[model samples]
Target chain A: MKGNFYLQGFLTFLKIGLFTIGGGYAMIPLIEREVVERRQWLSKEEFLDLMSLSQMLPGVFAVNFSIYIGHRLRGFRGSLALAAGIVVPSFVIILLIAMFFQAFAGNQVVEAIFKGIRPAVVALIAVPCIQLGRVAHITLATAFFPILVAVIIAIAGVSPVYVIIAVAVGAYCYGRFFKEG
Target chain B: MLFLELFCVFFKIGLFGFGGGYAMLSMIQAEVVTSNHWLTSSQFADIVAISQSTPGPIGINSATYSGYISVVNEGYPAIVGILGSLIATVAVVLPSFLLVLLVLKILNHYREHPLTKTIFAALRPTVVGLLLAAVIVLMTKDNFGSVTDTPWQFCVSVFLFLAAFVGTFFYKVHPIRMIILCGLAGFLLYS
Candidate 1:
């Protein structure tokens, strides 16, 4: 019975993984409907707590969210099953593309299709940046940091690793001395 | 040997990546494209499109694809490319897996800690910058063809780009729809 429950959980995660096109916040409503409403596995509060906790951690948000939910339901076994379910589809699909796409590397029609998608993809990335800025509550005073970062990295070609380290230390110190958290 | 390198690189990506997949794009570009030369800019953009249209996070999708492409591009067999994908996917997942587990014990306390609050608050704007940089870095001739070489295609790219921006940002057109429409437009026009 316990094993079957976790197996079902795995399937649920698999569904989540398979259908969650575009990932990130798009996943929130799906998890809400499936885990909170249909399955009644998590309370609204528990789900919110998990989402925030996942944000504080690193790696994939989808995986982090799954980790919280899985471990809650069945500890380590639940975590493994859900994560595996979530990742397998993406892994398989990309691998298939990798294996097959090169064969069409010279195809004109495929090249044309990709040519159209390419510029659109850049816009897709830009929209999120603007959206994330709003979410971060980026104001004029704080806006300078992000602008400088983009300029240096984009125009001047500085590595992001250095910017990350510098910003972290600088922000921590700014919080300690200039303002409170 | 390249497997080992892929593992190391993705592990570092996992360890440093924050603010989710989009934010991680900066780190991915820094390592996979700029540093390692595993995939070119256009290839990386294609992977981004695939990742978005597919299920799962950009981190995992890019890792898996980059792993396979890197190996295959290196003259490895397709079977070995599978192994490369596995190694990269595992590496990217490993840090966060261990991190979630490690923090599980002190989860409640850690979430409410003042230190965490300060750090997260500080990091929020930084992630915005990272995402911005990801877009800026990706805006290149590689993704949008150079005007000198193909003015018609280049003009079409700029038009499609603006249209997609308005469609996505202002009108909130579904990303999948935008992608498909752009693809169809490409097929109809270019093909």
Candidate 2:
């Protein structure tokens, strides 16, 4: 099978990993843009599906994400490539920063830029939540559920793992016993 | 012995690191600083600051830095520190790789089962909520500026936030360009 696309995908993960800051949620938009728009590696719904699965798993959200995308498109080796691509940038960047130590410590210019970025990153993250919400079919009737979820998590400070477990179990039991859609 | 300890610590971190990068911060702090005394709490804070300002996941970034710095802190050479970094990064990522493959195997096996489908479908909205929660969690005074205390910064932040939200959400402005623009705006205004 032609695996050239996986190579490009690996490079894409590398770029995304290098450029995208703030981690976790920040990577979501860039990955969505690349995989869904530029690369067409995954459909919108498929991306959301993979994202939800990634969250449920116990690891760094971005790592789990790359692994899923890699496995889906290019099997195990693909997963490895993508995972390394996402990680190597951070590893190198951190090591370099550590070596210099005093030079870049509390660098004002970098801090200012990130101060500007922190809010934009929020926007960057919020926009996709909305778009993916649509993809997830969160409509009027079911809107309350997601709102409750947001409240439980954001306000009450509940961990997302519990939310995932409860929802999955509820849906599974309901679907199995009641034959509901 | 140090390398072995680093490997074991990071592997455990990876295994239990749920929800996302920020969620793992406390666990990492406990292991590296509180438990192992590999680094000081302030040093760990510096790692966090560096990690936040740089690219990649926080957990992986912390692991890499902790591995190298912990070794160097022990008076090892920088070359040895590099090995420490490599070992920590790999160990942290290893569990995730193995776990993801396991889940994929099961999901692929039950690819056609309705119950699995139901569970998968039910998760979609929850993911939405979780993403929203991420934004909310991040929308602290630290990121957005406190509206009451830091009025000017707060107003400018609100503008930037709206501008970014509108620019991307409505006009289809690419996020990379948006990021650069915001960075420039921030430098010019704040600096």
Candidate 3:
């Protein structure tokens, strides 16, 4: 049974690594579906908790989530297996593509494909923003803060690091200075 | 000296990088542009544009390009250039792998910690901020020319943005499908 569970963990992460596009938050729902809803490996609460941890950690959220989930299902070995499985496909694909990227670097077809992907990427990131915002129970003020940040970064040409710093500081100040606690 | 520096720097990036490619951007910029002076700010920005549009993680793309340029323009040896980029990429990823293994070993002990839960909650909004930053950078790139000169590209970008927003929020389209559709649209429109 343990062996079976380890395999399941490995395969689950493998599938996520293979299919997930746009990375990070875009992969969240699919992950929730597999680990929480379908496999019953974790409860909704546990899954949400894992998500929070994954975010706090420094790496890609998807990869971190895979690690956390895999660890939950099996032991250290399972975690290793799952993390490896998840990354292998993308690592291999990217490596191979990198080798030949220059060949098609200027190809119009390639350019067009990316052009299309760009907007889709925007949509992909945006949808998650809204969904996750809802899940986080963000108030209108909180919601508007991120959108404002987005626009400033997007249209006003602000640096992202500054935005992150500003938000963190803003949130901290609000919590410290304004909160009635 | 330069070659060794590149190698060590990238190796560190590869080793410590936790949140994957996007997360590595700030660090990479800090090291390469701010600290090392290997690349200028504009050059770093240009590399970012290329990395995003290309196939691979931004880390690898940046490493490869930086490696190539470091050698070609600065007379650094090819091996040093390659080694530098490779090292950073590897360094960034190593921590996550090792940490995951360690966490797995100790998983049962901290499964229900409130501190862990609180940290995760705090991180959710931050991730959103990071993603927002990425979108903002891409949209406002000077190459796109103020939405005036490149009206068509601007329009396309806006349309796709709306499409993706609707698909993910209202229609519930999977991201993979969205990626495919966008790829196809690129071929149809740009080709």
Candidate 4:
């Protein structure tokens, strides 16, 4: 039974590592479904805790979440096992692709794949945008701020680093200079 | 000297990289293109496009590719290119590994604190901003000919953009399917 738990944890991470395309947020619902709903490895509350912990720490949220969940289920060994599970497949695949990238570098089929993937990547990123907005109870004012940031970065030719800094500064100024709180 | 610099830059990026691969873009651009002068802006943008199209995180892919290019251009031995790539890759990932370990140690103590909750709330909106920035940059980049010159391409991009938006938002279709459909569309129309 204990061995079964270890195997389940390994397989869960392996699936996440192998299939997830965009990383992090893209894997959230799938992870939630597998660990919380299907496998019953964690309760909903525990999953939320994991989410919070994953966000608070550095690194990819999905990777951090794996560590947290693995640790919760077992211990240090479990965390290592899960982390390996989440990283190994992508690592191996990326290394292999990088080594042979020149062969298919200009293939028409490859170009087609990328062209298709780009828009989908946009949609993948958008999912969390809409979901997070809903969770945050986005008002017109709050909604406008992020949209404005998006437009500035997308259309106005600003570097994202500066944009992030500007937004941080703007938020600080708004909170400090404008808001009563 | 160059290899050491590469290691340090990627290490910082990996350590502070919040959100994910996209968040690392700004730091990478700043460190590699702006500060180090290791690669030109056009090259950096190309690396980004290639990394996005290929599998794996943008941060790691760019590091490997950049390290390879930088070492080769410098007339270093081929082994140096491999060493540079390894150093950058390991450096970029090291922070996340350590952070996970540290979080494991302290998480039990501060798991339910109000301060922690407030920080998470604050971070959520900021993450949204970061993602928005990525989308904006990709759309507005000048590498693709101007919207005026490639009206068809622009139109196609917009069409796919909306199709994906509606498909995911309303129909709840999986994103992977959307990607596959877009690939098919590109093959039929552009190829």
Candidate 5:
């Protein structure tokens, strides 16, 4: 593989990694711009498919999505390059912050700011609930599963990993045997 | 030894961390704070708050931040603590990287397979459920004060939560902006 394509891939993701705030979901527009609009590396449809697949996979969404895009574009080497690009910014930035954490941790201003952001973060997480529900096509038939899973985790304090696996198995069985065409 | 433990714990976290960072918090807390006793619950809560406001993915930031704090607390040198952070970050990212490779190789062949479709179809709704569960998990007394313990603080926290939700969902305000506004609100009110 040509070195430049991998380098280009790396730089593209590096930009995304640095600029994206509020985590992976926020990177979508920037990613779309770089991959489709600017680079012309992927089509709109392909981007959408990759987006959904990224969400379904475990681990961070941006990294996972970049892996898919990079692999699809240029196989293993491209994937490696993009992975490094996407992660470098976060790694560097967080490492710096962690190093100074002890110094700034007890700052009254910082504490107060975190106090305000804490509840807002809760709200931030909740806003996505509505959007994701729409994407999942939540209907009466599918409604019970989310409610059941939520109850299991929230009330019973069950580990979510188990709930995820059980839901996948339950859905697979229903689709395979129970659901009619 | 601590390095190995950190890598193993985060690798497992990466493997099962469905529904992104918030969803993974309970598991991370269970392992590092509760299971290993690396950090206290209050400290873990602080890490979550910091991770949310900072750049990068929350999962990656949490892994990096927690890894450093875990080692530093263990009396390791600062350089070793940095190594711990790198290991945790890389380990947390590795599973998804490998999974993507396997997926790209296999999913192409079985893209149309009924079993695959069924599994994915079923997973969609449950993923949302898990995200919801993540929200509930974070709404602890750590993030939101208890009604009796801190009634006035609790009211303000609830107000911020509701405002963020309405602003983002209805008005389509960017989350980054909301975070900044909340920070100002915090400084204004608390400081």
Candidate 6:
């Protein structure tokens, strides 16, 4: 039974890592399907909590969530296994691409394929932006926060670290003064 | 020594790499391109483009590729370059591992605290904003192409972008399917 937990954790993440494209957010629904519905490793509410907390951390959401879930299921070893399973496919794929990148760098066919995919990537990213906005519940009163942060980072080229820090502090103060009152 | 440096550098990246991979781009640019000079701007752009199209998390993929290129560029052997990739990938995820553990520990106790709720409340909207910024940044000439420089390519890209955006937002087309459709579109039109 103990060994089964580790193997299950490893395989689950391996499948998630292998199949998911378009990065971490893209893995959300599949992850839900596997972790919440199939394995029942985490309940739906628990999974949602993990998702929210995963975003607040620094690294990739996929990895962060993997660690959180793995740790919850087994322990340190389980977390390690899950992380390894999740990262291996990506690490191997990118490494190979980097090694022989010169061969395909200017290849017309590859360039054409990438050119087509680039805009698709943009659209892929935009889907999540809209989804996240809905999840964040951006009302008129609170809409300025997102707009201000976007302008400061994207337009002004300010460091995102400072913006996140400022927003966090501002929110804390807002909560203390308004919500608590 | 190079491996240690690679580890430390990526560890820092992981600790502060908010908003996922895209938000982490500026920080990575600062560290690898400007501060360390490990990769040039064009190389950075190439890595971003490639990583975006490839599998896995963009942050992890970039770290793996960047670490390898950084080490190999330093007169290291190919074998050493592989080691560099492994080191960077592990070190990049380590901080998050520790952090998530710590958060679980602390938040377990503060599960019901209003202050905790307040912190997340602010973070939620900010994350959304950061994601929006990532979209806008990618829409630039570098990722999409400039209109004046190459009118045809630019027009196709814009059309694809609008088509994809609408397809995703209104039609709810799966992203992978969109990728396939766009790949075919690019191949037929450009190739």
The TM-scores of all predictions, comma-separated, are 0.94, 0.63, 0.61, 0.69, 0.86, 0.80
Is candidate 1 or 6 superior in DockQ? 1
Give the least accurate 10-residue stretch of model 5 chain A, judged by summed lDDT.
A172-181
Summing lDDT over every window of 10 consecutive residues in candidate 1 chain A, give the lowest-scoring window.
A172-181
Docking quality category of candidate 1 according to DockQ thresholds: medium
Per-residue accuracy of model 6 over B1-191 as CA lDDT, tens digit each:
87888898888888878767766665566567645778755466567667777889988998999899999889887788999999988888989878866767886667568877787777777777776766666676655777889788789988988998899889988666777788788889899
Share of real interface contacts recovered by each model?
0.76, 0.73, 0.33, 0.32, 0.76, 0.73
Q: Which stretches of candidate 2 lie over 4 Å from their true place?
A: A1-86, A94-105, B1-92, B100-104
What 10-residue stretch in candidate 1 chain B is worst by lDDT?
B107-116
Error of 2 at B91 (Å): 5.8
lDDT (tens digit, per residue) of candidate 4 on B1-191: 88888888888767666656666665576567656778655455545545555444456666777776566556786567677777777787667667766655676686565544554555556656656655544553332224778777667767877897888789987665776677677787667
lDDT of 1 by residue, A75-166 (tens): 87888888887888878887888778877876899889988998998899889888989988888898998888888777777777667778
User: What is the lDDT of every predicted structure here?
Assistant: 0.84, 0.79, 0.59, 0.66, 0.82, 0.79
For candidate 3, lDDT tens digit of each residue in A1-181?
Answer: 8768767777776677666555556567877888888989889998987787765556545666777777776756766776666665555554344445434656787767676666665455455555656766778778765566556655565544555456546655555555524
- Candidate 3 deviant stretches above 4 angstroms: A1-56, A65-82, A144-181, B1-89, B98-119, B141-146
Clash pairs detected, candidate 5: none
Candidate 1 C-alpha lDDT tens digits along B34-138: 778888898888888888888777888988989988898889888998999999999998887788678667866766766657777777788888878888888
**Stretches of candidate 5 above 4 Å error?**
A40-52, A139-144, A179-181, B20-53, B73-77
Candidate 2's residue-wise lDDT over A1-181, tens digit each? 3667667777899999999887778899999998899978789999998887787666788998999998888888889888888998888999888888734546777666656766776777678778877888888898888788878876775556567778889988988898853
Q: What TM-score does candidate 3 get on C-alpha atoms?
A: 0.61
i-RMSD of model 5 (Å, 1 decimal): 2.5
Highest-TM-score candidate: 1
The deviation in Å at residue B101 for candidate 5 is: 3.3
Best lDDT among the predictions, by candidate number: 1
Candidate 1 runs further than 4 Å off = A177-181
Model 6: residue B144 alpha-carbon error in angstroms: 3.5
Per-residue lDDT value at B63 in model 4? 70
Alpha carbon lDDT of residue B163, candidate 4? 90
Clashing pairs in 2: none
Chain A TM-score vs. truth, each candidate: 0.89, 0.57, 0.61, 0.60, 0.82, 0.74
